[model samples]
Target: MKQARLHFYAELKDFIAPNGQNKTIVHNFKHRTSIKDVIESYNVPHPEIDLIIVNNVSVDFNYIVQNSDDIHVHPANASIKQINIAPLRHLSPQVSGEPRFVVDVNLGRLARYLRLLGFDSLYCNNFDDKTIAEISSITQRIVLTRDRKLLHRKIINHGYFVRVETPKIQVREVLARFNMYSFFKPLTRCTFCNGKLKQTEKQNIAQRLKPLTKKHYEKFLVCSDCNHIYWQGSHSIRVARLIREFSKTDSPLS
Candidate 1:
């Protein structure tokens, strides 16, 4: 029987056995298996892997395991580059343009911040775990969650485990992780309903707003589905400032 050594780096290590901390696993096999399959067999998804190295050369998911080979796997958000493994599969490509996100119920604040940044972030406090998993799988939307177990779901292809606890930190963490500082599109989506906002004459929504709002704010946007009104209130400026602060941070994953 031939044996190989495997080492998972960064968040990839989260799936390894408790005793496997920063350590390599030795597995004996009679036939070769693709690196992707081996990794997924251990519960890590293909979408979360950014780099792989085998025997000191960059490799991809398709690389076949060989006897005595040393395999290293890195997560998409790790702050490292360059590994010694043959390139068998290229780095996984990120979703182009503004990446759409689906946040678990626990991440309501993060969802709001993502919306403030003009990303299509879908959030529902009432969604069950199964529903979230199904949405993530069917839409190919990136799943953002504080629950590590959610990201571990078998059906989820795109997912991220949020490490930050504070809402502000979480916003920065996501921005840095997705390299989305330059993609900010403010006020494009309804923060309340996750619906696209449409430009409307202030007079159209006069009755819906407070008496002061109707008289003071000229620019207005209304949700097509929920009819929620949005304006450049003091609250909007604060949210925008928070986004600007995050935009200055270096994206750890990019």
Candidate 2:
């Protein structure tokens, strides 16, 4: 049997088995295969990987594995000092405008949280993988998904496999990853449909508001797409607190 030793570094280890973490993984195979296939077999999606070194030589995903090969895989956030490394496959796309995203169906809460912070996040509970991939490919929208396999599609150039499960922490994770602290525009978007919120005259929506809401709140914002109204009610306190919590610096990746 042909054998290769592989080591996954940093956050890339999250996809591998617990027993194989922080150490060498011995992969046994009878025939040669591309490095991409071998790594995906361990469940680490290609989008999460930035660098691969084979037997001390930099190589791309298409590099075919050889018998007795030694492979080292690094995540996108790895701090490698080598300038001569092979060009990475997952280069951050040069987005021309504000970063938009098409989230997976399983990450609906995360999508809502992102929209709450005014990011253009497209999410539908019924959206399938093909639909998400197509949107991402055509619009250059980044894909946020928990399913690693969803990112393996060849059409997906910009995507991230959300590591954390909690919606709040996942928001912080995404902001930290993308350096999006400056992009925070809380309460400027409709959390329900990911539409921009526009300031509307109180009398324009007076009939839609309840008696207490009409009397108590004079200023309001309405969704341009859905016409849903938003106001600074008591719930705003909790939202502010959550925003403050998300604004703090999260711990570094392993």
- Which numbered prediction scores highest in TM-score against the true structure? 2
Per-residue accuracy of model 2 over 50-123 as CA lDDT, tens digit each: 77888777788789999999998888767887635555444345555577899999989899988888899999
lDDT of 2: 0.86
What is the C-alpha local distance difference test score of each model? 0.78, 0.86
Query: How accurate locally is residue 107 in candidate 2, as Cα lDDT from 0 to 100?
Result: 89
Quick one: RMSD of model 1?
4.3
Candidate 1 local lDDT, 76-152, one digit each (tens): 75666454334445565567777888899999988987787788889999988889999989998999887756765
Global Cα lDDT for candidate 1 = 0.78
| Residue 57 shift from truth in candidate 1, angstroms | 8.4
Report backbone clashes per prediction: 10, 0
Report how far residue 104 has shifted in candidate 1, in Å: 0.9
Highest lDDT model number: 2
lDDT score at residue 167, model 2, on the 0-100 scale: 79
